[model samples]
Target chain A: MPGEDIVLRTEALQKSFGSLEVARSVSIELPRGARHALIGPNGAGKTTLINLITGQIRPDSGKIFLEGRDVTQMDVAGRVRHGVTRTFQINELFPNLTPLEAVTLAVCEREDLAGQFWRPLTAQKAAIDEAFDILTQLQLADVATRPTRTLSYGQKRLMEIALALATRPKVLLLDEPAAGVPKDESAMLFSVIAALPADMSVLFIEHDMSLVFKFSSQIVVLVGGGVLLQAEPDVVRRDPRVREVYLGQAGYV
Target chain B: MTTVSQAATDPHSWLRGQSRWSYFEIAFWVIALLPFYFFPTYLTLASQIAITALFAISVDLVLGYAGIITLGHAMFFGLGAYAAGLITKAGWGEPLTGLVFAGAFAALIGFLTSFIIVRVRHLALIMITLGLGFLTLELANAMSWLTGGADGLRGVDVWPIFGWFEFDLWGYTAYSYSLIVLFLGVVAARRIVHSAFGLSLRGVRENLTRMPAIGSPYRFHLQKIYTISAALAGVAGALLTQTTETVSLETLSFQRSADIVVMLILGGTGRLYGGIIGAIIFMVARDQLSGMNPQYWYFWIGLLLMAVILVMPNGILGGLSRLAGRRS
Candidate 1:
């Protein structure tokens, strides 16, 4: 199933923090339009893999290829511009900006309008429209004009995804899309995320196996910083090793 | 400066409010212009306040809006002073051109140094900027032949507005010219901070790491704002040189840089008008205190600053806005 349509590929990624090996020869591939879920127990280096793929942290050894081009040497912004983007588990959003303004900022950034000082924001009608559309899609259109800080926890978390979507990323890495979200809102959040464009590859880190089993086309179970199994939802659910990894963990129901 | 409805019908309407004039803003500018006609004797002091306010605004752009904590912004101000003074001393004394040239000169230096400046953050950034300020001061002092050394760059001659009005002793022309420039600077600064670029700057300041995920490189935005801030500061410095006919080593002094930071904090940060209000409050307090006790004026100024800060931690303007918000 490893096709030429892979949008993101980590070739034998290895990282270590002193004596602690967080990622040991971790390799993963995300094909175009793939709905891949990265499921693992706590301290499984799920976030570390996302960080390496998004250029937030350097791997001790490996090559990160975006659309088959090596991007390991690139910076975070450079990689993002080349169609790699990620959302934080903690909801890293601009508290000072409205959802519309924040999303417009991302769209302007995507279109490279961030440098245009002469034109006012009103002049970027197309970008603003696109930003509003992204907000609408996220069901954040009702509160689009309110300050981001005033939004509910669920809404703010969705705003994070809105920002990622505004970048129009080819390879979207969601580091636990519903980290702090309540159980009821988590399903709704995943629904919005699951409705993202088919042409965009999505790799999400989710502890909620229900969402993972429900929304993910494939699941990659990570254990001890290494890929234990990469297969369909049923295969991952039936794997005994995967069961052992999450035995004591709250994630395995 | 902008307000949008929670349920706006049109997407473009969100930006429409930014262009509309606020009554309070108009009244503020009008009151700023009133001092020229009402209190002519204080015009010289008023002009100096305008220049200082512009300088403080420049600092605000870099530190407040861009989230760059700099302790040595006087480097650009001093560079502008010397550039304007030297250009006039070279026999071309066009006031408007001097302002533009001085701003450009400072911007050039800012852009050149931004490579090193934009790469650092927090305490390291503060030290590097302070180091840069000191380097400029020593360089200017060392080049006494060009800058007139400790004696100050003297004989800075500025021609009248369109060759009609001279920079008189009463400071009629200086007050008019400085106010106009300050007004334009405020307008331009307001426009920049409210634009898409400015919005992104706020985003960068809010979360430097988050910008990359959205595809806006933080370093380049910082570089652009830093350069723009330097240009405004240079223009302010050039205004001082042109109006006073002198450029001193103190322009680049650490005290000058430190003072603007105080004024910004005393007034507010992030907001554009904070700097101007801070300059006025500080300059007025200094003037009144110095007159009462010339030798121990610092004590009084320090006391007054502490009182203001203790009461209004967000600076005078920020506190006032919060009060107004509560009342409304």
Candidate 2:
């Protein structure tokens, strides 16, 4: 893998809650167009790491680089404007808006029309078309007019992806995209993920090993708030240390 | 599938397909026109209703759509009233010019305050707004020479509408002027709420966290809306001052702010016509009830309010919209 093509890089990231250090000297590099997976046991600070990367919470120390531009000091909106976007572990959608409306809002924001108060949103022909395209691609076209709150868990998850994609992000962080979906539904979700543009890098955190094994090109195993291993999926599956720490109990190796 | 394509092809399809102007709006206009004929004697009260409705709509813009809780909105209202009144006192009593001065002055103040206001949320926002309202009230009271202190600014002589229609005791000119302004204000507000900016505001209200992730600067949008809302409120105040031919410290009072909020809630929040409907019902009801028994009228008003809150928490228009099976 060419490391020089890094799209997202974290250097010695550190964070603590009171006395408990959740992230300690954590450094990660995700190359351009990489399909990356972050897997760790509960309390291994996976969420804390994501928050640090997204600027939801500031890390005590270290820097975050997006395409070699230091975004460590950027606020959430600033980072998003720099083309970094993420989906929540739980669906965070505008519940009252239909899928079409929600996606249209995202599209409008992306098109820099977020402040256009004079023209009606429906008048934005290109935005509406693009929003519908995104919804259709995510397999949410059937329920485009239905309010998001009324959607199924699987549909909501897809809508979350659609919202994130609407921003046309350079790097998309998906926090447990299949978290609440059934096994059969997750297959559909993963397929949609797999169909994403080849140039867009994706970093996801998932507990489901099958999905993880199938989706990620590279896997980073986190243990005790530190990187235990980083390798290709096949290599990670066979590693004895990885087996001893994680895969051994599941007997996946 | 065809609907999507059609929506894309015809730009006005989305605008026309949606029920923007329903019977409620039509009924509001009809009722607004009624005071001109049947109750010509009460044109003064009608003008008051129009002014109050405009103020309530301003409150609704922020509180309803943006989910910002404010308790000191009268700061802008009073500021506009004083600005307009002071201009007239200075012998520059051009009604149109005074209106512009009031709106711009109020908008300037709103823009300055929003830097602080948009930084906080929920209870802090409410308290800060309340504090601002009281602060302006005190400032107005202390400047007795300028604001006439607690006694109120009096002897404000407004120019006739278009330099022709003098404001008579019958309040015909004032009522018509206020109604026209109120109509324009509602049209502008309707345009705003239907626009992309308004959708982003709703998005922010629904999920603050998700908004920034989607590239919306939370404080920026809030501040923008706050300024727009304040400008509208100021216009309302100017209308009040112009019609009443007076500016008073009560315009900036916490009571004024609170009452407008209550009226907005009673009418419904978020909906374009909520404030107008709320203002009409509230002012009309108050006029009737207070006329019956001035001292104990509030007791009846309180009882009715409690009943409305318990039965339809969304307010009169919201409940009515629900009955009509339309989204409030």
Candidate 3:
């Protein structure tokens, strides 16, 4: 496929921590609206790649393009304004704000209306309405008024997604969206992902192969801090290198 | 009960429910008209209450809503007082003009200090502010020719409000004027604390990481609050200088800063009006105890403060609100 339509591209990204190299000249193109799964074993630099793209940490040398815009030097908030948002592997919702309030805050931030502190919250009806709609879409309408501290692990993870969605981002970076989800909830989460808008892209890091195989349009296998291969799921399943690195670890021939 | 529900439905519910406004309004009318009947001793207590209350509310801008704890608030208070006193005694301006200049001077000090202050957190920030206060106080004392050093400024002629209400030597005009300014200051402060900016400030206080991630420049918001807070403290100090017609080196002392903190905590931090109630209670207690026995009074005051601190951790007003909430 032509890379011109790509929303996010990392060009030979490199990062190292003292003697340990986390990412070394890694490159990839995530096309617009592509449901791309980044599958890797532990210490395979999945999170490091996510951080580099999101500007949490600077790469030693690389160019990051988000929607035809270079965002390599943008600070965290600057990156957010550029439409790059990520949910933590560990859920990072505001502990004290209600789910609706947290999502409304995100929506407000995206609109650049956060500085207006004189207006009452109830006056921001349009923002609140949009936030509630996102919460309902994520099956969190019942818990919208509940403080995130009281939500179940599954709900908290879902709220994190809802929080990210409120930003109206074009590219959503979900770091292990199913990390702590129960089996039933995992299926529900996959279905929810399967039902998202065709124009919005999802790039997620996942360890669960079954869920990855079921939902991903394309799989990018990462092994030892670099792209091992990028291909269709069936091609990935047949590749010996992928088998040796991942399936071998789980002792499945 | 009816008014409570009405308050909930009102768009201005935040203003209506604020104890700071309610208690301040009540105290304003009572104290403003007190000179008509009360003894001169009572009026003196009222003037002290006005000054102390102004300081506490100014500190509340940072402490209660912005979640910053300052131990050197007296720096702004003392600076404002000294600046006003020096200006008036040197024949620069009238009472109101002196107060405004005092505010501007304090605002400059606050703006410069906030660059270093906003970067630190908690205990370290407190220590830095404390050191700043002490440094200013020493500087004022060392400049004895202008400030009167160990003594204080005499011959400070503040005149009167509007050039007609000449302040009676017994302070009739001074007490009424101070009470009026105190009332307006409290109302203005109430508006700010309940504003949308105030809500965001609370959000920042709740989580700094989340605030910036949602598109706020955390440092800018913090610095703005700090500067505004200091200016308000300056106004309070200038008001005191106007009332007493004197500025002493003690305005910048660490004890005065500590006293402001004690007033805020005693009324209950974060409970808007707690500052005013705390100030009134503290000043009244101090006045009564000191009048009864000048030597043994401080010991009794300390015991009383300890009792209030231990018994009502949320302070008098906070405890009362909680009780009211429970009953409902």
Q: Each candidate's TM vs. the true structure?
A: 0.96, 0.96, 0.85
Cα lDDT of model 1 by residue, B170-236, tens digit: 9889988999999999889888887888888889888887998888877888899999999999999
By lDDT, highest first, what's the ranking? 1, 2, 3
lDDT of 3 by residue, A1-253 (tens): 5346898888999998997788878888888788889988888889998889887889999899887788898887787777777878987667766676677677766776555645655566677678778888998876666567888998888887887777777778889988979888888887887887887778888888898999998898887778889888999989998988865574321
Deviation from native of the Cα of residue A18 in model 2, angstroms: 1.8
Give the CAPRI class of candidate 3.
acceptable
Give the per-residue Cα lDDT of candidate 2 at A59.
94
Candidate 2 segments whose C-alpha is farther than 4 A from its true place: A247-253, B1-16, B326-328
Provide per-model DockQ scores.
0.73, 0.57, 0.30
Any residue pairs clashing in model 3, and if so which? A117-B196, A117-B197
Question: What does the i-RMS of model 2 come to?
Answer: 2.9
Q: Write the per-residue lDDT of candidate 1 for residues A1-253, one digit (tens) a residue.
A: 5467888899999999999888878888889999999988888899999999998899999899988799999989999899999999998999978888999999999999988776888889899999999998888887888889999999989998999999989999999999988998899999888789989999999998899999999999887888888899999899887887778654422
What TM-score does chain B of candidate 2 reach? Answer: 0.94
Q: Model 3: per-residue lDDT, tens digit, B104-138?
A: 99999999999998889989989998999989999
Pick the winner on DockQ between candidates 1 and 2. 1
Q: Tell me the interface RMSD of every candidate, in Å.
A: 1.3, 2.9, 4.9
